[model samples]
Target: MKHRFFPAVAALLAFGAAHAAPCPRDAPLPSGFERWAHPGLGVAAWQESGTYQATLPLGRAVTLHLPDIGTVHFIVPPGGKGSHGPYGGMIGIDVPSGATYRVMLSGRAWIDMVQDRADLPSSAHQHGPDCTGIAKIVSFPLHAGWHVLQISGAPDPTITVMMSSTP
Candidate 1:
């Protein structure tokens, strides 16, 4: 087969580069995170070297960032209903209203994402992924803040959080 003259252009098309962004389908946290945690319903988290906690009220989404290693986690509450999910124990996060948040990271590994809808409730367990090379990202909507957004898992991975348009 013939190759394209532009190497960058060739790679982008070959790997669906245009679609690459902090998306739920794309796990932002590094792959080694699998060794730390996998994505799922209930309280999915990672324990590095710190602690965190928060409780979302309702119809809100919270975004947490671990820029130290390039990883972002969000806890969103699906409005109303049973909030069904594959698992449980995942912390309830409080999200800011009308806000767009995103996390960015790059590496190679696997991040399993699971969420609970208002119609279905998750099991209340921990889920995660095995990240590698510092690659991961997560994006979602927010309208409030939960007592959540805690550093529950990674007791100390040397993480940090950055808010969008902070006053």
Candidate 2:
């Protein structure tokens, strides 16, 4: 039992050490994330409300509020429903045209795009560039219209988020 535990503990330490450190707040972002380098707008997330209380703009970073995961009434159940994080919330977005858009998050979290009362499927996923402060980026094919961006299972109460259309 002791030998087994030692290996497990060593593996956990190695995993933690392998994780990249977050970039400084004032540091310049990589080429694809240049717009996120500036200060972001602060917005409160809505809980238990279907109404869109805040709108996330394209190409701009917003400091979004993530209410307690237990309190939010998501449009649809998140894929990361089993997340151990205590925070999550929903926001609104207006897709100007039918295109592929990337949703970038400052930390690990689950993202769902909902339109017409249905959850849109993600097209692609990737990790942020080294030392860019970005943790994840998920892309979804969206059409022109109002859509809901549901963020769930976030470890923090607030996170920096940005959306941009693929050029």
Candidate 3:
């Protein structure tokens, strides 16, 4: 009986360890995410209810505050739908030059890039490095100009985001 119980105890312990809490908010980011180390910007979501526009700079992290999904006016319909909740928003990004850029998010959310009134499909998608605060990373080939980043179906009202040109 003791031997059999030991296996169960060990399995429970392993599961607990595997589900440890996310890294501290101030913890240093992984190598590719170092650009997010700087101070993060806090901005509200742009919704159809009002005339609001927010811009996020590349290579800097921003804490975006999203409104209810029903309130957001995405430039283009999001490719992915939100599951956790109705929290979603949009922010503008100015790409200095045409290049592949990576967008990092701290939580699960749908990301869509729009330019010239069209949706730009993601070029690649991957998970963040272990122990990094990032939960997902999506890459897109962008051109130099203004673009809209639509965030939808976030589980929470706020999410941390960072974008940087791939080296």
lDDT of 2 by residue, 1-167 (tens): 99999999999999888975755766776676888877466654555254465788888988886778887878788878566788888888889999999999999888889999899999999998877778899999999999888888889999999999976
Every candidate's CA RMSD: 14.2, 5.1, 3.0
Task: List the candidates' TM-scores in order.
Answer: 0.24, 0.80, 0.83
Model 1 bad stretches (over 4 Å): 1-89, 104-133, 147-167
**How high is the CA lDDT of each candidate model?**
0.32, 0.83, 0.81
* Residues forming the 10-long window of minimal summed lDDT in candidate 3: 44-53
The TM-score, computed over Cα atoms with residue i paired to residue i, of candidate 1 is 0.24
Error at 96, model 1, angstroms: 3.6
Clashing pairs in 3: 82-153
Of 1 and 3, which scores higher on TM-score?
A: 3
Q: Per-residue lDDT of 57-160 in model 3, one digit per residue for the tens?
A: 77888887788888777778778843556788888887899999999998999998888889998999998877776889999999999888888888899999
lDDT of 3: 0.81
